[model samples]
Target chain A: MHIVVCIKQVPDSAQIRVHPVTNTIMRQGVPTIINPYDLFALEEALRLRDKMGGKVTVLTMGPPMADESLRKALGLGADAAVLLTDRFFAGSDTLATSYALAAGIRKIGEEEPVDIVFTGKQTIDGDTAQVGPGIAKRLGLNQLTYVAAIRSLDLENRSIVVERRAEGGVQVLSTGLPCLITMLEGTNTLRRGAMDDMFRASRATIATWSAQQAGVDDIALCGLRGSPTVVKKVFAPQPRKEKAKMVETAGKSDAEIAQATLDTLFSANPKLETDLRKLAAAS
Target chain B: AKKELSEHFKTYKDVWVFIEMERGKVHTVSWELLGEGRKLADKLGVQLAAVILGPPGNDLKQAISDAWSYGADLAYVVSEPLLKDYRNEPYSKALTDLVNTHKPEILLLGASTLGRDLAGSVATTLKTGLTADCTELAIDDDRCLAATRPTFGGTLLCTIFTLNFRPQMATIRPRVMAMPERRDAKPGRVIEFKLSMVEDDIVTKILDFVPDTSTEEAHLAYADIVVAGGLGMGNPGNFRLITDLAAVLGAEYGGSRPTIQKGWISADRQIGQTGKTIRPKLYIAAGISGAIQHRVGVEGADMILAINTDANAPIFEFAHYGLVGDATRILPALTKAFEARLAVRRMAS
Candidate 1:
């Protein structure tokens, strides 16, 4: 089995801060990490490869710096890494990004047939959750999203079953091979790389591909020109006129403070007190 | 350039909301989008149309009526056995065909699992742009759909426009928009479409569905009130304080993303941008520092009461009320206070 796991390098959202006056993201000193969700996809791919005796290739589409993320995935036991990067791919939205990645996956398939493609449920920076399905649509692959577990895999039959997270329940789905799966976060823990793997990854050369090399026929479809959506404006959420009113707590016990807070809360919103009272009575 | 692109899509009219239904029940987010779609439709002076694709049944009929009551002016219905179960192949085909035949200026869908699954495929098939998890939707001065959504883990908001794409598409999460009042309205005209796809066309098959029987499943999004904890709760064992407080108020209990990472709570109960976006009437955040991710999820709540040991926690900036104290100490006290207050109110009633 040949599995291609798609990963992305995104700025650590937790550490990102907006400029107070300019009201824009301060990306200057922010650090970039492998999108945390993608780690789960890589680990799941590694586990599948280990069990089924196959090769796992990690793939990413980003700037040249994204090679670091691919190397990190190799350290985690992936057999190979591919970086699809080019100047023409900048400003690609989810649709355009998926188009580039799909082309890269097709090029990879020329050497060895890929049985499965894996991606995280969504990227942290975009958080759109559209790329996996987008890729599947472009490549004509069965799209299985929000997969919590791989229940069974019949290699001979080219069949796979997975437990998919749904709105109110879990759906056990069966699909053919050559499918795309978006692994949900927290489903599995990433493994620590062994000494040998770490050394191999540090020295492993990542294969880089431009849009043309990746078999993208149309340059217009690879970047801003291909993107249908345009970002009109970006700004910080407007701050409320007043900060949270603090309940007095100078030498006051927790109970007293709670009572005082409730009093103030009720006085400010008289309907809230009545609603709560009614709910309590019903409960 | 903008005018040329707009001219190409001039044939597309009206605003369409995808009404998602499964197993005879329509997802509430569908109605929520219709409510929001109504505003955009009115702003653009276009009709609000609900798109329904399902097996022919009373549920489908009821959804049509409900859409009308929720402000839809008309509906497009495709009743096919293949669409009974939402296999992305047929649903996307049905939706894309509808958009192609009768183009719409704007299309909205709920950001639920099913909606996301179908939207991505339909958008890709049609070569259109789709914005996901939009917090706000409106028609801009340019007569284009302005889809505003949180970006970079909700630290900033960005408004997106499908400049050249006809049927500019967007998906909004559950509870993000207010539920519009359902009024008695005359049922609107329904346009029926046929999905020519067959069973052999679908690649994925549903073997079985196991409904959530575990009581631990968190319905945080629709909860009337929510109480959540964070790393400041100190340890996993202290999460019970949040649950205890929730029990008194008949509210759901959740945790911040850090707590989920720590295994202090299940991932489903995580309340943040990466987790669930809730708009409860009352949100009590204990020990949480209110990262942008968490703030975006809970900022929709009618009232937010933040309790933390640090008075300067970022949570205090947007919280409606703040109590500066150890959550371990304050949670229990607050629980008791609520219990006593409710008991008194119950007795008085």
Candidate 2:
């Protein structure tokens, strides 16, 4: 079995601070992290590789600097790394993104048929959980999203059963291999690389592909030209109209703040009283 | 101020929201977009339309009628059985074909699992710009759809401009916009057509759909009160404090994206920009640092109560109420309070 894990290099959004006065994104000195979500996917892929015995290829689409994320995946026991990078791939929306990535996965399939593909539920920056499904759609792969756990995998039958998150309850779905799985976050722990693996990762050669190399026939379908929605503008979220009405405990006992806060909350939303009641009964 | 897709946008003319349906029933979010689409259409001075793809039957007509009441001026109906269960092929093709034949000024979809899957593929096929998870949409003075969304990891918001692109597109999360009241005695126009395709013609079969199930998963989108944990919950063990409070409140629970990243909670329970956006009437955030991403996801809540150890944490800035205390201690107290209240109700009953 061959597993391909798609990873992305995202800016450390937590560390990114907008200059308090200027409002400009302070990019300088801000470090980039292998999107934390990708690690979970990579770890799941690696764990599968270890259990099932196969090579793990970590793939990404970003600038040349993205190779760092791919190498890090290699350090964590992945067998190969592929970087889908090109000017054509720049400014691609989730749609174009899926197209390029699907092509890359297709190319990897040419070398070795892939049995499974793993993606983080979504990217922190895009916050759009569309790409994984987009890739699954374009490639005609079964998409298992919001997956909690892989209950079992029967390689002989080419089937895997997984617990999927749905609107109401967990859906225990059993599907075939050669599919795409978007693992839910916090499902598993990603192991750190040992010294030997880290050294090998530092020296591993990464495969880089452009549009033609990745089997993309149309340039228009691979970038901003292909995305259907347009963002006319993005600005800071509007601030709330009123400042918080801090609950005051003044002149009362030490317990006043908590009680006062609850009072203010309930008074503001009459339904909350019923909700609290409903909540109590449910509990 | 600059248009992002200026060179190619003039060709689009109508506001189109994908009316996603399954097993003959149009999803609630479809109607939600129509309510939203009505506003955009009026702003753009265009017709508000819905692209309905489903199996041919009574369900399609009912779905189209539903769209009409939801403020859509027209319904572009493509009927086929293979399009029924939402395998990407038929739906994407049908929607793309409709877009090519009748150019639209904008497209809107619900940011659900099904919507996200189909929208991405159709947009790619049409070769146009697509924005995901838009929090707000409006027609600019130029009559262009201004798509406002969180970006750069939700650290800052970026307004994307597909300036010259036809059919500006965006997907909105559920409950972000209030559901407009439907006119019961209302009816509108629907154009019904048979999609010339079947299951055999489609390449990928609906081999199966595997579901993710966690007893703790609450599908928080519709929860009245959401109790979510954050990195401040300390170790993974401490997450139970949040769950205990949530269980006591009888609310679906989640954590900030950071908590999910920390492996303290499953991604299904993550409540943030990359996870789920909840508009519960009351949101109690425990030990979570309120970052822009987390804030954007939950700010829709009517009232937000934040409890974090750090007095200066960003969570306090926008949180409706702030309590500077250890969530470990505070959560237990809240749980006990709710538990006792619930007991009283049960005994009274």
Candidate 3:
């Protein structure tokens, strides 16, 4: 049971603030971290490897700096790391991205048959959960998204069951092995790397693969040339100019403060009380 | 049609909206998409069709009629017992089969769990581009679907074009579009299709369903009143301030994306672009900075009241009501006030 986990290094979106006057993204001084969601996938893969006695290879397609993320995954007990970076692969959308990743996974499988490919539900930057399905379609692998938990695995029979989060309920789905699974967030806590594992990770040699080396036979299908969707424009959201009406509560007692705010709330929206009363009565 | 589109795609006509249903109940987002799809159909001077795949019963017929009332000119129905519950393999195959058999120029779906799951697989299976979570959809001069969505962590908006694809497909997030007016309950042309595949063909089998029973299940999407906390809440202990206020007002409690990432709240309770898009009558955001990510989710709230110590917080710019004070103190004050007011009503009544 060999597993490949796809991870990306993204700028911490929480710290990213837009310049008020310019309405431009302020990326300076914002540190890059492995996509927070990807950690759950990486951890899930490592846990599977631990239980099944297989190797977990962490893979990423990004700039040279993305090696830092692969190294971080290695520190967390991934058996191997591969970085797919090349100038030609730049500007790839989800389609080209899935193409490159499928090629990379195929090349890895040429050495050892890959059983499961894992990725986060979606990348923070892209927020498009298309890549996993795209890759699955390209590679003809069974794809499962938003998996909350891995229930059972029978490597011999090549069967697995997972709890997938659906809209109103959870679907306990059973699928065959050699499928691609996108782990949902908050399913498990990422384990901290031990001292021995940290030392081993530092000494591990990260495999470097260019577009050609990653089994990308047609370079045209690997980057911007392959992407069908085109972005027409990129602009900041227009801000609303209306400021909120402030409720005064300066130096007032708790009871008075509550009374004043309630007064303003009821006065401004005269029907609010009626609506709440209706809801209360019905419930 | 763009000049780049091959002659093979020229024959693709009409706009189709996938009508989503579960447990014999139609999801409201499906109607929203149908409403949106009707406009694109009108713009292209083509027919607006609703595609329904479900079990064989009156539920499917009612769904088609609902779609017709929502301005659809036609309805495509594929009824089968196997299609009762949404399994990606069967649903995607059934949808892909429908698209290939009857080529529609554009396909629209609601960005619900079922829609997202089915859209990705169907689009991939058809080898076409799919834009997800679109905020806007319009037919371009060239007849391309201009799907616009917030990108780069919601800092900017990007309009994507599937220029060469036969059926330009997109999934619009719920609450982003206005529900269209229902025409005088007219019946549309119904085209019924067949599900050729059997149950054994699907590799994935549904074993059991466990409905969400956690106390933290914040029904934020449909809540009339929502109270959300942010990083300003200080810590996990202070989250009680939000829940306490919500309990008093019978409102739902949620948090910003940061609180979810920080593990202060569950992911379901997070309100933002990546989380849940909530449209409540009143949304009270405590100590929220109102980033574009969070703004997209709460902007639909009928009235937003924001409380933050920083008067310069972006939330104030959009909030219907604003206050400059520590939420730690303000939250408790508001809670006490609401409780007192409601308690008095209970006694008087």
Candidate 4:
């Protein structure tokens, strides 16, 4: 069996600072890391590989710098890495993104058929959680999102069972192989890459692909032009109408301050009084 | 309508909330939206309406009456067998078709799992503006919908406008707005829309409905009191400190988005713009730095209490109460105090 994991390099959102002068995002000197969510998907893939004995290939669509992340995935035990980066793939929304990724996966299939495709539930930056569905729709792959656990996998029968996290509960689902699964975060830990593996990842020649090379015939559908939705603008949020009323208690005792704070809070929002009564009863 | 909004949006004129009823049960968030829709509708001086899409012969008519009592001026429904279960393709096409025929100035949807899925596609198909997980919705000085939500990882608040777009779109997280009282209990106009698409046309089948399983569901949105921890608590194991305080107060315990990002908790336990909307009576944030994205998710809480080592942490800006102290130190103290108070109460009982 052949398994593929799609990873992307995302700017460490925690360290992203806004440029003071232009108010534009400052991307320079900011470190990039594997999308924290994607690591869960990669680790799950590696675990399945160890149990089932399948080769794991890590795939990424990013700038040239993204090779850094691909190598990191390889260091963590991905057997191969492929980077699909081209000027045309820029400005792709979820739809366009899925299209490009689907084409790249097809190219990988030409070398060897992929039994399972894995991805993170959603990207922190996009937060749309639509790309997995979009890719499944386009590639005709069975789509499973928010997978919490791998209940069972019968490779001989070409069937896999998973627990998918839904709105209110988990669904025990069984589907055929050749499927795309987006794993939920915090389910598993990523393995450490050894010094030798890290060197191979850093030195590996990441197969690069352009739109045509990746089998995407329609350039229009490959990137921004193909995307139906456009983020016309990204701006700062508006300020609140009023600042919070700070309850000052410099010298008061903890109990006294707590009482005063509760009183002031209830006075501002009377419903809070009723809510607290309800909580107290529940307690 | 804007020069770029979909042709369908050009014809939309009033405010409509897609009254979501899943599994023969009405989502309570619909009522909260009715309360808000009334304000947006009144501000626009037009009718407030609801779009009910469900299977036929389900007493959806009663759902219509409830909408009237809740504040809808009219209810448009597409009742058919194919509409029984929500399939993205069919539902998107149906709602898009409705917006085209009857132009509404504003469209509201509960920022729910189903709502988010449908709204993203519908907004794209219509090519209009959509703001997801909004904390506040109000009529601006110019009478346009000013959608306020947290951005930039929950550090700041931003208000978005569609400018010239009509049928302005927004999704509010569940429990963000207050559900008003239903006094009039009147009936609104009900118009039924016939479904032409057959089930065969739809590709994906329900197969089955899988509900969430975690024993502790995050009630951050509606909890009377919430105690949340952050990375400042240090290791993932220290989250027990947060739960201890919550246990004594009978409150829900949550973690900032970063906690989930750090694998300290599941996404279900995360609190922020994309995670969950919590409007508790009191929200005590421990060790949280208060990024804009995280702020958007929790600002609905009636009162915010911040306990962090940094006095300048953005969480303090809007928190109702502030303590410039170590959360690792203060959280334990809070837990003990609440435990003592609860013990006193239990003995009295």
If you superpose only chain B onto the true chain B, what TM-score does each candidate give? 0.97, 0.88, 0.91, 0.86
Task: Write the residue-wise lDDT of candidate 3 on A1-283 in tens digits.
Answer: 8999999888887677667766666779998999988999999999988998999999999999899999999999999999999998987877788889999999999999999999998877778888887777778777788899999999999999999998777989888878999899889999999888889888889999999999899998767777667777666787787788887868887567667878887888988877766555554
What is the two-chain DockQ of model 3? 0.57
Evaluation by lDDT, superior candidate among 1 and 4:
1
lDDT of 1 by residue, B150-169 (tens): 99988889999998888899
List the candidates ranked by TM-score, beginning with the highest. 1, 3, 2, 4
Per-residue alpha-carbon lDDT of candidate 4 for residues B249-301, written as tens digits (9 for 90 to 100): 78988888779878787767788766777877689999999877778777777
DockQ, prediction 2: 0.35
Ranked by lDDT, the better of candidates 1 and 2 is 1
Residue A33, candidate 1: C-alpha displacement in angstroms? 1.4
Q: Estimate each model's TM-score.
A: 0.97, 0.82, 0.92, 0.79
lDDT of 2 by residue, A108-221 (tens): 999999999999988777777778878887787777777778888888998888877544445666677778998877779889898899999999889988889988888887
Chain A TM-scores of all predicted models: 0.97, 0.89, 0.93, 0.93
DockQ of every predicted complex:
0.75, 0.35, 0.57, 0.22
State which candidate has the highest lDDT.
1
- The DockQ-derived docking category for candidate 2 is acceptable
Candidate 4 local distance difference test against the native: 0.76
> By DockQ, is 2 or 3 better?
3
Best by TM-score: 1
Clashing pairs in 3: B1-B142
Which 10 consecutive residues of model 1 chain A have the lowest summed lDDT? A274-283
Task: Please state the error at residue A35 of candidate 1 in Å.
Answer: 1.2
